[model samples]
Target: MQSQNELRNLLQRIDHKSYPAYKDTRGSYDFGNYVLSIDHVQGDPFAAPSKVSVHVRGGAAKFPADLYRMKCRRLAVCDYLLRQFGQELERVSFKAKGSGKSGLLAVSRPGQEVLERTACQMDEAKGDLVLRFEVGFPANGRTVNARELEKIFFTFLPECVSHSLFYKALDEKAVYRAADLAEDQQYIRDHLKEQGLVAFVADASILPRESGVSGRPMKDAVKFTAPESMKVSFALPHAGKIQGMGIKKGITLIVGGGYHGKSTLLKALELGVYNHIAGDGREYVITDDTAMKIRAEDGRSIKKVDISMFINDLPNGKDTSAFRTEDASGSTSQAANVVEAMEAGAETFLIDEDTSATNFMIRDELMQRVVNREDEPITPFIDRIRELYEQYGISTILVAGSSGSYFHVADCIVQMNRYKPQEITAFAKEEADRFPLPEVKPPKQAAPTFERAVRPDRAFKEDARMKLKTMGRDGISINRDTIDVRYVEQLADTEQLAALAYFLKYAEIHVFNGKRTLRESVSLLMQYVEEHGLAAVTESSYVPCGLAMPRAQEIFACINRYRRISL
Candidate 1:
């Protein structure tokens, strides 16, 4: 350990030396109020920024214990502090600057929701708060600028720490309010099934986006109001007596014309797995965490999945049970996705016809008449949807515009017209009774069992070095293979991707074995994360600063997509 003055002197001694000289500055320094640690140094100015952390004792910061007494509340405080630190960094203009990435400071950037992250952590047992961030470490071309580096360490950082860490410098009410909102959202989600609902959208919530590509709420979007038939209310701990449209746990349909908010409402429901910020328009919208969005992914890989429930009797003698395909058709892929979701413990399915396979969704009377039941290999989802709910307790919320065949099986129906939902289950039932289709025979086989053997050839060596990198939000490159997750709609943030990449590598090293199934391995990986926090995934010497928690479902999907899997 060294004093701040001594660290400054070391930086001065390394000035104008080769870039490798910056390595000597990697050590802990006592800065009175906080202890600063430069855990890792960048090899070059153009390389990734240096890893740094600041630790402030609990007594110095004076934060209330209640703020972190609960896991959800603690995460909220960590998110708030990260935002405050980012704001402080934006306010400061460094006096010394040089080449690429010089004089820049950054923490993990947050999305619309607050998540458990490694960027900031509070250890109540140790009575300390640790904030991890990245610094460029000022440089002149390839040479170090010791004077500018001293200013960053001794001057700029202390101000950021003071304003962001101390309870007095922050708006206490705002922080508490954010935590309360997060808690209330969790409470609502926890009670959704108890209330006999699959999803809930609060009254006055905005469901429209700024654009098709943008996730931000529209400026003049219509406020949501529940129809009298579907409107339900819940009394939460922090937020008392909130009213919303509670989608019941059964086969439900949303039907309307084009551009009439059918997809928008479903989008909100899909995203409801996460608790939004207070002013995020859909803050009170909550759904089951196990709810997975089902869609057609034609090019995705399927490994040893039991999609035989929906697909069987191929043209050739291709077995649907223990199915393995490198490139699946649209209908086959959708069926596999649903089965995989079920294997991973998905309780509810959210589907939109726009993104679904036309033939897989429904085969009407005309098509059934043209092709005999014995001749057709596919069983439309409409026939099995009711059976899925009644037998398995699995619920489905589907958006359908072209087909009324689903009306026969639907327990609830809501029409979205001009951005407003209307309960039309009665109307839909009457229409179905007036013009019913031919009675269809149920499939012969029972639900297929999901089982797969771990491939012994895919074993990961303990001493082997492997690298992981995130390719946008939907893909991760691990060693030589690229895991495609483009159809995984639940992965909302890049931080989650980064964390997932680390978890995959971590799983390969620690959890994978020939004895454990992929699902079992993923469960063990999640259990490890639960016990050790997100930092456990990273092997870097410095604390991992940008990791966010991802659901076990997504992690399982990632592992299944790896082409190296053997049945």
Candidate 2:
């Protein structure tokens, strides 16, 4: 077994590329030279500290750099094992946080599922555990001291591994041994079948061909480079930890309990698209030239923006004026930012639920009408993105928790849970029939509970408690219960305030708007209604009697007018 210093010395010998140069605030160049940061540390109380998370800088290229590191890791590990346990029947146990400590781990074995001849144990090892993948060794029951074992393990898979070693893990079946074309096709088909994914090699596959820039143009699509089934960590320091699974083209449902790396994965996908390198670890192999990133704009201080002014900048303005909102240009600006990325040559459209919601729901009905009319607000944006891929050959990748809306629109689905990602059939009833959704009972609204059995006498204080549950996909619901005066908060933004106001209208007309009453807010609205010379029309839009005074109408009449829309 070698010492940590010896391992570092060996790692320092590996070749690396010029570090990526970064421009500082003062415009100074910083090279992308590989820097070996401490990934994790393990030390025996009686021995030297074991440091992991080392990487050999391969080069300036994105995914290859990490791959190079992995290669160096393999070399280090193999070398260490060869030197320390050469021909020795010693049991080697590798452990991860959650993935059991010891098992019939996969080594450089020929079979996909090979079990080494040894009883595997997953107990908590004393030293730090930061080895690449898993480890398997012949068992000898000989107990090596912690210091020697740490030294040997650290010798191989040095954090400072090199790029030349990064082997892009490829499908073995993709390798063609025969010269026959039919054999090659059969090989590829068998590979796909074994991988459990649909494989088609058309003169023009819908995916590769559809993503072209001019052939069949897809609307509102996204492009990710070198999409992999499992999550790949794509940044330095963190190195090659699994981040998020990358899907080629389709709706990826990144769903899980709260804070389970769903949004992190989505953001990583966006960053990879924008930079062509891994944002943190996950990288994309973009085949096309364009990628777009779309997100929501929460700032609402801007009272007004000319919608027509921005709409005029579209490739062909067909009058989307009816869907204009307080932040029309801002909304359009968000969409346009993505569109500009596409126009400039982005094939992929990276958008989240929030941005899509704000952009699409600005004028839901009118936008839907535009989409139906072939003048898409969001969906057409998607269609055009697909057109860029399909017509001109562009690719798309969209992420959403509620992918039910995007199933028909996407070509595939990358199902992700926590950090683990797996590819599944985009359409239902495909080979993915094994991934059955767990049946969950629909969330029921609990009976109303009063804040206090008796009313409080304080006029300023409120004892009103409301428990609301918003329905979620597959019987999941978000329940919110609070006694605070949330409804009284000032309008944070037009969209949020508007949504809250609409919700309040169902409860009581005399809702709070900041510290003032709705009447005070109505006065401001009255001013806008008058300023726009829409007093008659806007008045009728809210109240049918043309009454200037605020009064509650019958619930039935209000329900009838609105047709009982629910969240």
* Local distance difference test values of all predictions, in order: 0.85, 0.29
Model 2 scores a TM of 0.28
Question: Candidate 2 at 295: error in angstroms?
Answer: 2.1
Tens digits of per-residue lDDT, candidate 1, 305-353, equal 8888898999988989888899999999999988888888889999999
Query: Please, what are the lDDT tens digits per residue for candidate 2 over residues 230-332?
Result: 4333222222221322344433344444444445445443322111111112222211212444544432211112233123334455443322233334455
Using TM-score, give the best candidate's number.
1
The whole-model C-alpha lDDT of candidate 2 against the native structure comes to 0.29
| Residue 147 of model 2, lDDT score | 31
Residue 547 shift from truth in candidate 1, angstroms: 1.4
Candidate number of the best lDDT: 1
